[model samples]
Target: DAAYLQQQLQITLEEETGIQSTQGEFKFMVAADAYEETERVKVNYTSEDTLQQASTSGTQSDNAPVYDSDGSTKVV
Candidate 1:
């Protein structure tokens, strides 16, 4: 999936470079060597289950929980 996304980005950048050249601008060229690519992995976690359970009543901090689209919370 990353390879596919990179290919699409390359194509879009190439088109931008061509358009810029036609406009008498040379700043839109893309340099792959100037970029660093890293692979990102998805992580599953729950803050309400992991942190709230560990906090005692009246001792909780002011930090609020962040929720995902599925309604699961994850502490920031």
Candidate 2:
């Protein structure tokens, strides 16, 4: 359930680069899209990085943007 919740958390592009979502779901097309349109702005890490959640007690979590060799985001 944590993973699912985390994924929901990552659904933030709607607030960042696109229009607000309806229950976390958004429209990803105009005449047809927007990621490339917005230059792929840095949003929250994807649910794949949920393990990097904020500190639970006193330890901090390391959450840095991960990029593939091609310089594209690996998790975002």
Candidate 3:
């Protein structure tokens, strides 16, 4: 459960970082207790500048199969 929670947090972090350039560093602090109805995870993020430049580009590429006339497949 911890691993899955961490993965979700990482995904959230990446998304947040992508949208806003000011979000520099992120720190996750998880509590040890669990709840019956809903579980709350605390997240803390810090940045030196209120408005910073983008740390990385926002381009994504995937390797999908492409079909040719001869039924051959190529990755693109």
**Per-candidate clashes, comma-separated:** 0, 0, 0
Error of 3 at 61 (Å): 67
What are the RMSD figures for all models against the true structure? 21.7, 28.5, 27.3
- Summarize candidate 1's per-residue lDDT along 14-65 as a digit string, tens digits: 9999987866643323333233221111112354555656775425554656
Question: Model 2: which residue pairs collide?
Answer: none
Q: Mark the regions of model 3 whose C-alpha exceeds 4 Å error after superposition.
A: 22-76
Model 2 misplaced stretches (Cα beyond 4 Å): 20-76
Cα TM-score of candidate 3: 0.27
lDDT of 3 by residue, 16-54 (tens): 878665433221112223331133322112242322323
Writing each residue's lDDT as its tens digit, candidate 2 over 1-76 gives 9999887777865465445454235443551256654543433444425545544422432356678999897654
Question: Judged by TM-score relative to the true structure, which candidate is superior, 1 or 3?
Answer: 1
lDDT of 3: 0.51
Candidate 2, lDDT over the whole model: 0.53
Instruction: Show model 1 residue runs off by greater than 4 Å.
Output: 25-76
**What TM-score does each of the candidates earn?**
0.31, 0.19, 0.27
Cα miss at 1, model 3 (Å)?
0.4
Candidate 1, residue 66: how far the Cα is off, in Å: 99
Largest lDDT belongs to which candidate?
A: 1
